[model samples]
Target: MNQQALVDVAAVSAPCQGALHWVGMEQIALPLRVAGQTIAGRAAAGVNLVDPLARGIHMSRLYLALAGLDNQELSLVRVASVLETFLESHRELSNAAFLDLSGEALLNRPALISPLSGWKTYPFTLRCRRDEHGLQAILELTVGYSSTCPCSAALARQLIQQAFDERFTDTPVTHDGVREWLGGEQGIVATPHSQRSQAHLSIRLANGLDDLPLAAFVDRIESALGTALQTAVKRIDEQAFALANGQNLMFCEDAARRLHQALRGQAGIEGFRLRVVHAESLHAHDAVARSEWNWAGS
Candidate 1:
């Protein structure tokens, strides 16, 4: 069959004449480069309908243009090329192009104090646009961790001290006796509450940037928080994790501040924004906080 002989309704004029800001396909299943590796992902590809009288865009043109991403590592430069091809393919119908890619990346993480390591999945999205304002991109991802509430830790410690005072007021307190008591429920009556938490980060990249700093960002943020959630663990790893929680208890504010400072020191980007969420074990509601640096726009 002659492809051009088939009906092409998109070539016909629209009954109503008006410009549409965006028009194209969304949630297109595709393979994406994430953290320097290829992963199964979905992409939303579109372009602005600048020509008001045009019935619709050449949707096939845009879909075919996505072939540029195949086997290519995702980067701002690579995305710009595909977007440029969108405008070139629709030289008269469109002036702007947009692409959004979403995927989950699995990274191997070592246990806190054990030789065991396991895979951790980080969900991420990369949004790209080419318009009169020039090329723009935003990299966003979520990292999970554990947060021990500082207030809860303090209150639990106070209760333990009170219990000790009541029991040892007349008894001679020795190291062995204190150790035995601490190992029992009577001395360490209450325990602080902790919850699995997550941090959401969005970074605006410089136009000339070549690679996404996802792995680096994950490492820095996890280090700053000091209690990244573990994937596999032994009894020793669990003990080490407990020690870490006890030593680095924080509120939502502290987690956000730590991430803010950590992101401030990073490069290859113009600005960043972060949010930390603590799923509270003590209450039904979650604790959330947000922070940003130079996030207004470029």
Candidate 2:
């Protein structure tokens, strides 16, 4: 006699009720690729499963769908597509879905006046929403740069001038003499405070094109703000940094406005929100400014 094979299937439960909320599946890890580089990311997903009668949602499907993602094909487009898939898989229960991807993006930067190079990592985030209208994508990028306090720089200059005056009261001190005095043990009386700064930029894209040169954008921002952070520093690099700080002395407001201008002029950016935070070395609190651009026509 032939034995019958047993088949098992999950029992379908009743639908849930009005305005049910389902939130979980935080910190799901996956590999991603952006701007031609592969990076690891932990994506968080949440959705509102609204069924008038069901007891719970199918949580395992969300993890399985995210785990099935291919790192090589990971892009803004892919992310949005996956989010839609998540919504559709539970279309009967969920009316909207929200997905967020967080990870570190690395880049190689060359040192100033030196042949050496180093790597820099910036935190990146991308969020998407699936609703009745369609899909919307948002890109958030964080970049680090250096900022010199304008007040400190001015004070340093004043102190240097006073030192020169004190040294050459009887006779005018030559440039060499001033340089020597400033380079001596008591030469330059004071130095300005420069601190590592961070800029958080969030852009709303019209499409799912994640191919934007995020690293290059970061470089442009650092250069536009006039203070690219240094990984490996030598004497020359330090001098170069001092000069940069002196020239690009800016307050937190100025930095935010400058970043806003850059983002507004950048092509393919429909709209953007910029937040610049300068960690002040002189004080315990940080200075921050925020700016937003509205692209009505686009």
Candidate 3:
């Protein structure tokens, strides 16, 4: 039996001829090494099809070129090399190449007041575009923490004062009794409302910088907020977290400003944008704020 040769249908001329702004594959499953960790990532690879008369691009070649990302750790320099390879593979057909790789970055975070440690997964994305002029790269990630409302804390303190006055109106106060009451829920009649909040950070890397600084970004944002969410905790750790929340109270606007200042100080960042989301426990809707810096003509 004679086997029919495989047909290269993508290479044939299109019945309706037109150039495409972007043509390639997306959601391609691939394992990527980034900042010393192997991540399961999805890559969206594409290039501008410049030849209007040409049938179509070689999609398989674009897919095959993504293999370059698997062998080396992900960095701007390495990503630029991969994009160069993509353009080379599609030589006459494309002048620009784009790659977007997204995945969860896992890290071991220790408890605030205990020796226990657990893993935290941060959703991260790396995007790069390469053209004749040069390569532009950006990194994005989300860090979740606890946000305590300053207004709510003050209101809570007022309520606790009222409760204390009502309870101790005639009764003589004793040190041991007061201590016991403080240890119990009766001592603090109300508590400030706190909610799970997240900071979405997107930073454009300097043209000459190659380091991603994923962990550094996370550390800075969490340190600014002062109430990073814990993965594993003991009773002491929970108490410590509560103390942190009490000490570092903030609103959505406060969180956004803090992140803006922190990101602006990073050396690797040329331009940046941030969005802070506080899932309000007191209200039905979420509180949100956004900030951007150094993004003008470029």
Question: Highest TM-score, which number?
Answer: 1
lDDT string, candidate 1, 17-87, tens digits: 99999999998888877666778988899999989999988888889999988857777777888999999
Measured on C-alpha atoms, candidate 2 has an lDDT of 0.78
lDDT of 1 at 55: 93
89-132: candidate 3 lDDT, tens digit per residue: 88889999999999998888999978999989899999899998
Error of 1 at 71 (Å): 4.1
Residue 187 accuracy (lDDT) in model 1: 81
Give candidate 3's error at residue 109 in angstroms. Answer: 0.7
Count of clashes in candidate 1: 0
Task: Count residue pairs with overlapping backbones in model 3.
Answer: 0
Residue 164, candidate 3: Cα error in Å is: 1.9
User: How many angstroms is residue 205 displaced in model 2 relative to the true structure, after the best TM-score fit?
Assistant: 1.8
* TM-score versus the correct structure, for each prediction: 0.94, 0.86, 0.94
lDDT of 1: 0.89
* Overall lDDT per candidate, in order of appearance: 0.89, 0.78, 0.89
- The candidate, 1 or 3, that scores higher on TM-score is 1
- Give the per-residue Cα lDDT of candidate 3 at 43: 95
